[model samples]
Target: MKTLLVDDHEIVRRGLKQLLLEAFPQAVFGEASRVPQARELIMQQEWQLVLLDINLPGGSGLDLLVEVRLLRPQAAVLMLSSYPEEEFAVRAFKLGAAGYLTKSSVADEMLAAVNKVLTGGKYVSVALAEKLAIALGNPQQQALHETLSSRELEVLRLVATGKTIKEIAAGFSLSEKTIATYRMRIAVKLGLSTNVELARYALQHHLVD
Candidate 1:
């Protein structure tokens, strides 16, 4: 089996490599710590499984997931994130991820998720399962933030947490102008102006830290 791991943190990549190696002993592994590098690797090889992080340096992992589906339609992509599963998993599944696993999840859970994805099944944690059920049960009661694309939501959270446009741009390796555009979109969607109001809305809605 061939697998690729894409995460910005070297320590995380190292630790995950060790843990996944225990389960996929014969798997050939490729690692990349940035979006450009990851994209290049993906194009250069056919990976059976892709372990992707949600907050990549140059882009959201959801963007990469889209690229993966286009480039390697048959490969299973499992998204990993430090964010709560409820925050991003639904977007991930919609974008064609085979599974979503939080970094705080236990090794056994991680293994189970990987195995399920590798075997042609979707994996969802109990928390995510509950969230999914709630959404299904109340299909019309979608959260306001749910309407935002993953990238837009990410920018909204960052802005809410007092990150300046430049800081948010740096975090995503995007230009300030690009982040400004996202800010406009967020304002237009949320029907709010000013960072203070945005911050207030995010806090009231529990969309940010």
Candidate 2:
């Protein structure tokens, strides 16, 4: 099977490779450290499975997930992230990711998720599953952050983390003015004024690290 791993950390990529090798010795792996590199690889090849990290150098893995769905629709993507945040997981699934997994998940869980996704099934952590259940059961109880678009939520997360416009722009490869506009839109939507307010909202909502 051809598997492509998109993560910025070499150690993470290596660890995933090592873990997967125990189960599938014949697996062929390709690795990419940045969004651009991952995009190029996706355009050039067909991967049976893709292990994609959420946090990348210039953008979130969600962006690449969209690209993969378009360029290699047959590829099953299992999203990897350090954050076990339910909001992120929800966005990922909505974007067509086959599975959402935290990096902290046990090897067995990871393997099971991989197996399920590769078999054309979807997987989610138990915690995420419970959260999703509650969310779907109580649609009217949706949190304010849920109203934000994926990009808006991403901007909010970065802003809540105290990232400056320049830094956020650099990470997104967007202009400072564009970042400023996002900030303004976020403030307007949230009805919040200062960074402190945004940070506090994020913390209260468990969006911030």
TM-score of each: 0.86, 0.91
Residue-level lDDT tens digits of model 2 in 1-209:
99999999999999999999999999999999999999999999989999998878777788889999999999999999886657578888989999999888999999999999999999988898888899899898777777787777788888888899999999888999998998898888889989999999988876756
Best by lDDT: 2
lDDT tens readout by residue for model 1, 1-209: 89899999999989888998898788789999888899999999999999999777666688899999999998999998877777678889999999999888899998999899999999999988998999899988776778898789879888887889999988778899999999999999889999999899878766654
Q: Cα lDDT for residue 176, model 2?
A: 95
RMSD of each: 2.6, 1.8
lDDT measured at residue 112 in model 1 versus the true structure, 0 to 100? 95
